[model samples]
Target: MRLLLIGPPGAGKGTQAVRLATHLSIRHISTGDLFREEIARGTELGRNADRHIRAGLLVPDEVTVGVIRERLARPDTEPGFLLDGFPRNPAQAAELDGILARTGSGLDAVLHLEVPDAEVISRIAGRRLCREDPGHIFHVDHDPPEVAGTCAFCGGELYQRDDDREATVRRRLEVYRGETAPVLDHYRGQGLVTTVSALGQVQEVLDRALTAIGRAGSTPRTP
Candidate 1:
């Protein structure tokens, strides 16, 4: 099933996206990965996108749309794909519709993971990352490291990134609310949105998401 997954940063959308795509046997596509792939391959579009990114500016819609267009053209997407972090606003959503319309196809559903702003702040602000290895992430509440203010792996200093600071996280939440509200509203008008609570255990959320989408028995099921 062609699907769009939308949620705030701390809503565990990334984890759910991977699980849903795996269970459904579909590609899990995120714009950040796409951009990284492009930049790593040193393509012209990648260079242009990199320039904008280096300048701390949003990549132009045309560039972003082009990236998605090329990705969707791949043979792998023929079966299905779970999209994340694309079509960030209504304008991009319209562009996505045009792209799919050309091929006589469109999204089957848009899964929205709902999380309260207070919870979002708590979840993000407590995050700590290892300076030596960004992958070594720890949460003050959910998963603290063996030693406080340090990473279990590599013995690196664990620091809360500026992006994860309370103030910055709030700012990000505000931006998400302002931009994605209209996109969600637009999808609701088209009757393609499925709202799901993004709380509880990972397995539980995964089950809930699958059940919510599969109520129509539309998406393929894994054996």
Candidate 2:
């Protein structure tokens, strides 16, 4: 179940990645989480990435690819892994192919979660994250917390991330359009791209994703 999940900022790729990884019993490798971990530890890579991230710029491909290579070499990835957020452009996509080639492994499918730009803006603008755990996410309209401005899972304040701000999200969307969209074509050329709509309830989207992947000829592992 080696898969790459790609989508716009508010397409719910992160949530689906976690669920798909669990369903397939594969390692879930999220570049955003990886960057956060590195930055929290103040590693050299993190220090470098921090500058680009804070400036609302994409991290250099070399730095991003280095981190990914290290991660992909780990034992857990030997079986399979679900990759999210790393290959943001065609160059990184090609670099990923090179990295995997060294290990004689490659992606079975690249899932593109398609959502309209307007929907993306609406979703991201309403999204909030828990102070204690960013994983505890909620949307003001779609999935509000029991108490407004508070986390449902934990009694913590909920705040919108800077990246989720309307202006910032628009900028991010521009960057995605300029850089990341080509990666889809790169994978499509390999016949490894699967398109799925990102709008729907969580389970509904998951089912669509699963069906898409299954049609690609890969089945999730039994729990």
Candidate 3:
């Protein structure tokens, strides 16, 4: 199914997107990941996005929309895709509609992960990461590394990101409330949104999301 995943920062939207996409054999597209890849490559788009991302601000609509269009046009996305961290507000949602309209396709569902602000703050504040490979994530209180201060994958030193700090996480959450909440309402008004509780274990939350979508007929179980 072509789906969008929307939630506040620390909402585990990325985790659910990855799990759901793998389970359904669909592509998972994340604008955050896209920006990171581009920035790593020092592409024009990446350079433009880097400054905003570093400051925990949303990338401008034009740049973000262009990147989403390019990703949706890829071959791997032909079957379907689980989109995470795009269409962050009403404006982006409208732009997404235009992109889909041009492609002669439309989104099947929007999975809205709902978690309380306190839970979100707790989850993010305890987060840690591998300095050498930021992709490797851990939680200091919940899921620490095998060896303290070391990554299980590359032996990289584990550290906390400035963006993941308490103050920064709070700022990100505030931005989500101000900017992304409207996107959720837009999808809800279209009757295409399924709200799933994202408060349990990662796997439990994933199951809840799948069940919610399956009941909505967005995902069909295969024999």
Stretches off by above 4 angstroms in model 1 are: 216-223
- Write model 3 residue lDDT over 1-223, tens digit each, in one string: 7889988888888888999999999999988789888889988888888888889876899999988988888889989999988898899899998888787788888888999988888898888888899999988778888899899889999988787788888888888889988898887877788889999899999999888878767454221
Query: In angstroms, how far off is 189's CA in candidate 2?
Result: 0.4
Q: Which residue window of length 10 is worst by lDDT in model 3?
A: 214-223
Q: TM-score, each model?
A: 0.93, 0.81, 0.80
- 125 in model 3: Cα distance from truth in Å? 1.6
Cα lDDT, all candidates = 0.90, 0.90, 0.86
Model 1: per-residue lDDT, tens digit, 94-178? 9999899898888888889998888899999999999999999999999999999989988999999899999999889989989
lDDT of 2 at 189: 85
Error of 1 at 159 (Å): 1.3
Q: Which ten residues in a row have the lowest lDDT in candidate 2?
A: 214-223
Q: What are the RMSDs of all candidates, in order?
A: 3.3, 4.6, 4.6
Candidate 3 structure lDDT: 0.86
